[model samples]
Target: MGISAAGRAEFDQCRLIDQVLNRLGNAMAINRLIIAEGKDSTAVAAASDSLAEQNESYRRTKRQRAKAGCDGWQRD
Candidate 1:
């Protein structure tokens, strides 16, 4: 029972990881467009700060999952 519950939790986490990967791709494209626009310096700075935090969190999760022996994940 405990083992099945753990497996289910891991499956949920894998789904989350996939979602994060998709959002990260979107974030990259948004960042590029913001850079190209070259407007709203303060807003861009704030957004960049927020993105840095999110990137750190995403990386942390990826690292933790990797340590847990999760597979099929890669980072650029």
Candidate 2:
């Protein structure tokens, strides 16, 4: 038998979540590399601050999407 519509939707949601998590992991790795390769404290701090802002923005967008029922998962 084939999967139901709900099941397929759940599968798609899970896949999207995994893809998001993978991208976060890759971003963290890149941030680490930046810090490790930086020559001075100021350089590292600036990069860290920029990355932190980007992460916060991403989180804010996700929260907005979730609130609007636009994210993959059902809210209610």
Whole-model lDDT per candidate: 0.72, 0.69
lDDT of 1 by residue, 1-76 (tens): 2558877787788777768867876785686567567698976887677678767876887777676556765453
TM-score of each candidate?
0.61, 0.58
> Candidate 2 lDDT, tens digit per residue, 1-76?
9989987876676566556756766776677678889887887897798778768756865665465454555554
lDDT (Cα, 0-100) at 43 in candidate 2: 74
Best by lDDT: 1
Clashes of 2: 0
CA-only RMSD, every prediction: 5.8, 5.0
Per-model tally of clashing residue pairs = 0, 0
How does residue 7 of candidate 1 score in lDDT? 71
Stretches > 4 Å off in candidate 1 = 1-6, 73-76
Off by over 4 Å in 2: 40-43, 50-76
